[model samples]
Target: MTRFLPPVTIALAALVLWQLVSFIAGSHSVSGVVETMAYLFRMMQQESFWLDVAESGTAIFYAICLSMLFGWALGVVIGLNRNVSDVSEPILVTFYSLPKVTLYPLVLLLFGLGLSAKVAFGVMHGLVPICLITGNAIRQLRPVYIRTAKVMRLSRSSVTFHVVLPAILPELISSLRIGLSLSILGVLIGEMFASKRGLGFAAVNAMGLGDGTRIMAIGVFLSVCAISINFLLLEIESAIRHRTARI
Candidate 1:
């Protein structure tokens, strides 16, 4: 009971404040929590809503898989070498700092205005932070661990599999959680820009029709999805950390 009290209290307070503001405005331009929830319930009954969610979810899934595969591998390679990290770190940081949305035009040109474009856009957006976070985590490994690997005369693959990966599992999992959220955001952004189907486009359509309740409903749904994923990932990370400690 105590563990959940704070968040439940804050959520209730926020809903009350939102209702108060919406009542004061007395316009359809803003929706109260109750109205939004009502709209969300209606929307969930529609097959189209599920289709849009599925489309966005698919794009996000593919994008995250690609980003994690390439980003983790590159991070490990660069992180294990001081010279490579020194040369590549600045470049990676520069790319990470850039507005990834600006590259959407180029990605669209390369992949066309289709599923490929959305996946590519999302991968680019998510890849940077994962790569950087993983690199930093790897670089932080204790010198004693490195010495132990060398003392064992372990091959590169053996070292990575048996030592480096386990040591960095917690930080890497956290990075993956962040990466998943960013990938979803990226996919939604791409869908809003060009796709015929996706939750983002659904929200955009609602906006054009001046259906504030529907727009808010979509936003709330997306927020809930993101929060759920984050919570699940956190639990998995926590479990791994506890197991690692026990080992």
Candidate 2:
């Protein structure tokens, strides 16, 4: 069903709908979309846009790595230790439920709206989901592997490396996919709130100038980036699952 529909069809349908709305209602909406596409092309022609993308991408990647490292470790510890899970699960849930963006003022105060602030925001956004998902995934593991390792008299480090880590890696990757998107959003927010350059800066500037088309262009660019990333992640995840199943 999914293959039959094709993702590009959705894009085509959306564009058609957009054009219809613009034509029936006003030219502004249609022109805005076209203008946005033009701006996107214009942006592609310049080096600055690419540079800004790289900078934002770097921030997001860093945040993802940091979150994954910290979150995975904490999740594993919590999952393995009943006492820790009991004590910390609720705390983690509370933080996860709360909107991390609400901490913007505090983050800006501490990090002063620099790259530090952006990284901090990304970390906050990326951490909780990774932690929760990793913990849950690990928690669901059957004890067969552990039991086998114990019966075989495997050393603690060996058992953990050869058994536990592999079992939970897929979960960590799944969490990472979610966290990466969150981190990207965080970086854009940080840049929008206070930064000299980045896609977010472009967006803020567009709005300030009442350049709705440019704003829409920025939005379209972000959407394309997001869709591209999602497709890549999905492919990688599917490959991983297939390989794991074969093993």
Candidate 3:
């Protein structure tokens, strides 16, 4: 209860602000909290809503898996060699700084429409932060750690699982949290631009129809989901840090 209080308070405050804004802007421009929540509840009861959710969820899952796997592998490889890290870091940073939306046309051309496009967009958004964070964390790892692993004659797999992973677990989790959010954003953008299905498409359709209530409801729903997942990730990271500290 205590742990949840701050967020609850913040949510209430945000609601009050939202209602105030809606009142000032008039209902035509912005939906009230109650109205949006009602719409969201109704939306959840519809079969089409669930279908959109399933479509988006599948894409998000695939994107996250690929992003984490490839990002971690690349990060580890780069971090293990100072020369590689120095050479690649600037290029990676430059790419990451690019506005991803600008590349959407290219992505569409490569993957075409549907799940593949959505997943690719998501991977594009998610892959960099994880790689950058993981690589920096690895670079910061004490030299003694690697020397000790080598001295013990540990196999490559064993060393990675026992030493490298544990040492960078906290940073990895942080990267994951960021990557997950970006991946979701990317998928939604893909849906809005290139796909006929998913929550993003629904939101875009709502916008086209001037259905402000539906748009607000979708925004509220996505916000709640993102916040909940982020909170869970933070808790897990904290627990891991505590356990690591004890060890």
lDDT of 2 by residue, 71-108 (tens): 88787787777899899999988987787778888999
Question: Ranking under lDDT, best-scoring first?
Answer: 3, 1, 2
Q: Any idea how many clashes model 1 has?
A: 0
Which candidate number maximizes TM-score? 3
Writing each residue's lDDT as its tens digit, candidate 1 over 1-247 gives 9988998899889888888888898747688888799889998999989999898888999999999999899888887988999999999899887888889999999999888999998899889889888889999889898889999999999988898888999988998999898899899899888889999898888878988888889999999889988988999999999998898
Higher-scoring candidate on TM-score, 1 or 2: 1
> Which residue pairs show collisions in model 2?
none
Residue runs of model 3 more than 4 Å from their true location after superposition = 1-3
Query: What TM-score would each prediction reach against the true structure?
Result: 0.96, 0.90, 0.96
Best by the lDDT measure: 3
Candidate 1 vs 2: which has more lDDT = 1
The lDDT values for all models are 0.89, 0.81, 0.92
By TM-score, rank the candidates, best first: 3, 1, 2
What lDDT does model 1 reach?
0.89
Off by over 4 Å in 1: none
Give the lowest summed-lDDT range of ten residues in model 1.
26-35
